[model samples]
Target: MTHVPIRVGIGGWTYEPWRGSFYPPKWPIKRELEYASRHVSAIEVNGTFYSSFKPATFAAWRETTPDGFVFALKASRYCVTRKVLAEAGESIARFVGQGIVELGDKLGPLLWQFAATRRFDPDDIAAFLQLLPRTHEGIALRHAVHVRHDSFLVPEFVALCRAAGVAIVYAASADYPAIGDVSGDFAYVRLEDAREDEPAGYAPAALDRWADAARTLAAGGTPDTFPCVAPGRAPAVPRDTFVFMINGAKVRAPHAAMALIERLGAEPQR
Candidate 1:
């Protein structure tokens, strides 16, 4: 079996609560990414979802992180919030053109997260997927779509993602719809139910379940997971998995990520 790489991390490095706990005390704000990169193999850049960043900023981010670290950027709101998905080509282009390629190999997946109100429209989604560039400046770009609406829980939606080679984010949360379908060559998962009471954020049993699921995904088989609306066919090849501990009980997210990494036997920096 191929040893598929699995990266575990939190949404962002800069959080007030994590200052003294997750981050070293008296650590400079500017060096947060540098420190976080040493511990977690990956990080989801949530700031990009709110605003566009300059090329220099992206370059600086790339330079700060260590080698083998991955930064998954969230697509800007303008690119995904339009009433008509077909008309979002220019917006999407502008977002992608904004020095994202500067990250180079450090760049991982580009996450396109839709609002809960955004229902599933097959034609609209297909048009938007078509607009996604397969490559950015000759570098291959991976795309992941995170649909929050329950309307997206359909076989047609899964088929569209599979055909487009876009990964559908497996977001496990009680408040939001969780879809365990694997569509693309990679698996993107966001764990949103981390509890503050639990020392590791997630219960030990829950982490074990997720670890097993990650192993199965990396080994090229879809594990029988829950909260799935439509279970799609497995991919022909094994896939690398990116798992992020996000939202609920946000303060303990880093701890949760580290626990999962340890469970996978990926040594995290102390």
Candidate 2:
């Protein structure tokens, strides 16, 4: 049995509610990342979406997390929220060069999230995808796109992502459409429908479903439960997978992530 790595995590660590709930009542706020990173295998850095960080800041982040813990950066809004994505070359260049290399081996994929109004234009998207650099400061870079518009739910859009070797973010949201099509070498998922009443964010049955889906993704198989624009699933080559708990009942995000990690046969940080 080939078991590829499946990292279950949540969005950024900082939240006023988490100060007392997820974190210890008397714990230092500065060490929140350290605590959160230990519990979850990866984190989607929402802060990077709005602003760039210095090399020293990224280095300090790398120092806080343990080895094998990954950090997925949200690509700057300057790169994706625009009338013409092809013209985002300069913004992409600036975003990529913003001292992200300091994260070194801890760096993961860059998530380029599109606005709900951003429609699918094959030529424009393909051009934008072409602008993404393969490497930055000698380290390899991977990219994922989260498109919210219903226009993107087409086979042509999936083919564009496949041709570009960029992953399509499988987001579970009430307002946004979820695509199960796999285009890149890895699978990235955002689970956004967590509940406040459930201790694990998701109920036991729902978590079980997600766990199974994640295992399938790790094996390079797309979940049949999610709507797919493409006809079939990706090849069954073992690959790394990232699943993040986001939005909904935000306070239970960490607990949901840890629960998923445990379901995947991995022990969460105590």
Candidate 3:
């Protein structure tokens, strides 16, 4: 089956610049999102866990942004604790439901970012997985399982996700084992900046190689993997792709995204 266009975005809003030339300016949330939307189609909300999503904020977000934009929310800490796993279905359900309601239709995916100490407990994982409702009929929902510490990305986990019909997120970080065998109509790739000295965006030479590889992967249904090498640069694999680079200095997401769009020869967004 033909896949949807790969939707690429960044991790969050705002960035700190090292140079004194461009100082950071305080802006409204909607304005920030609207500015981001000009280049990136989506963003991952890391702050969602730090604070609850008020209904009013969600309304403002929907009102200020254009249509066809997306947001990926990180699940709250309370929803994934050891206590919640012990017969706390109501709590988890309410949390997820509230997140969906607050994010509304623009919500793209729910990221399940596990703690560093949280290991792979088959029973716990299954229990947590069962608590979530399936993706809505018209909406696309992906449950991204991110294990911070050592955890097995075993075939069984991939099988469970396949059966459940949830897209698993694959983050390309240095020194991390590449998890394969994910089954879903869609997928997510996070390219975090690994090189501190390098520029805070995509590297041109690297993009040349990755773009070719991505096209090759798209031609066939074979499995492919992309790893973060630098800002805006990832080793592209075959198949549909959505890459979000999280390394930017003073709001460089748009610049990096524009670079990638030009590298891919894909239509520019703005």
Each candidate's lDDT (Cα)?
A: 0.88, 0.90, 0.58
lDDT of 3 by residue, 55-74 (tens): 67767776655566667787
Q: What CA root-mean-square deviation does each model show from the true structure?
A: 2.1, 2.1, 5.9
Per-residue lDDT tens digits of candidate 2, residues 134-229? 998899999999999999999999998888889999999999998889999999999999999998899999999999999988876777797888
Could you tally the backbone clashes for each prediction?
Answer: 0, 0, 5
218 in model 3: Cα distance from truth in Å? 6.3
Q: Is candidate 1 or candidate 2 better by lDDT?
A: 2
Provide TM-scores for the models. 0.95, 0.97, 0.76
* Residue 198 in model 3: lDDT: 37
Could you tell which candidate, 1 or 3, scores higher by lDDT? Answer: 1
Best by TM-score: 2
The residue pairs found clashing in candidate 1 are: none
